[model samples]
Target: MIYSEKVMDHFQNPRNVGKIEDADGVGEVGNAKCGDIMKIYLKVDDNGIITDVKFNTYGCASAIATSSMATELIKGKSVDDALQLSNKAVVEALDGLPPVKVHCSVLAEEAVRAAVADYYQRKGIEKEIPGCSGNCSCCHLHDEHCGGDEE
Candidate 1:
């Protein structure tokens, strides 16, 4: 599979590649079929800005690269802005990935949403994460009102 230069760069030199011991929020997502897993850690300030972000990924180069790029894109951005992050944006930032590897980007996006959702839960804020399955460990909301994009 052909990989973009950006993808290769990120794979070789991933950014924010460790866990935050006291992270305010953490998210983990995976594709069982592909055996790819991504875990994201976030530290949010009192102002609702993401002060720090980190990730750990286990999978192909695309998975690692996407995770790295996702953290880089959201750092220092507000939680609201981070929620706007999509797999398409991650793919675009990486120049592109093999069609088969696109799912890695999707996992990266979901990981971000899951982390933000966890943040909300910790803060006692009632919020739903878009695109979340509501069945995942990252999302503690187990009600009929969970999951999917808001209309």
Candidate 2:
């Protein structure tokens, strides 16, 4: 499967590849289908802004690229904004992804959301998952909320 130029660029030079020491929130998730894992670190301010974001992903190139892209998108953004970051947006930000690789973006999206969830939990606040469950648009069976576009 062919990847977009943006995907290759980010994968080759992944940003925020390390963890934040004493981070305010941390999230880790694994893709059961691929057996790949992603861990996200976040430093949030009192105002709920994500002052810093970083990720370490053990997966395919798309996983790394999507992780980098997700950090770039959420850094300096509010926790609510970060929660709204979608897998489709991740794929779009990377120009596009092969159908089979679409789930990598989903992993990235979930990682950020999980981090935000952790943040709220620390404050003794409960919040719901902001977006869809991320079934992935690439699969014909799950295209309803998955948004089968560009792919």
Candidate 3:
């Protein structure tokens, strides 16, 4: 399994690695088959900009790298813009990931959407999470995050 240099760098030095005690929103996702679990935290300003982002991941190098890159992509972006983030973009930002490890990027994307959904829910906003594929097991397990009926 060849990894990109960016992927290795991120794996060795994962960013935003801890939980935020006062996070405005939080999201968790896992792939039981691969045994990867990811949690994302966000602090959004009242103006709808993401002031900060963090993540905790337990898996292989790809999982940690993808989680780190996802945070970097969303921080300082508008909530709406952050919601537009996609796994393909994450993969591209990382230079790329091996075909088999691509699922880690999907987890990163889902984690971001889940955290934003939590933020919206906390603000009493009734809105659908953008970019939700509704195919991840996390969505079926945590319906509130995806706003979809569990499969």
**Which candidate leads in TM-score?**
1
Q: Is candidate 1 or candidate 3 better by lDDT?
A: 1
Report RMSD (Å) for each prediction in the order shown. 6.3, 6.2, 4.9
Quote each prediction's TM-score.
0.87, 0.83, 0.86
Top model by lDDT, which number? Answer: 1
Q: What is each predicted model's overall lDDT from 0 to 1?
A: 0.86, 0.80, 0.85
In angstroms, give how far residue 23 of model 2 lies from its true place.
0.8
lDDT tens digits, residues 1-151, model 2? Answer: 8888999999999989999988988887764344467889999988989988889888889989999999999999999999999889999999999998887787788888788888878788867766533222122222343343432
Lowest-sum lDDT 10-residue window in model 3 = 133-142
Residue-by-residue lDDT tens digits, candidate 1, 55-147: 999889999999999999999999989999999999999999998888788888889988898888889999867878523532222122233
Q: Candidate 2: where is the Cα deviation over 4 Å?
A: 31-33, 131-151
Q: Tell me the TM-score of model 1.
A: 0.87
Error of 3 at 86 (Å): 0.5
Better of 1 and 2 by TM-score: 1
Clashes within 3 Å, all models in order:
0, 0, 0
Error of 2 at 107 (Å): 0.8
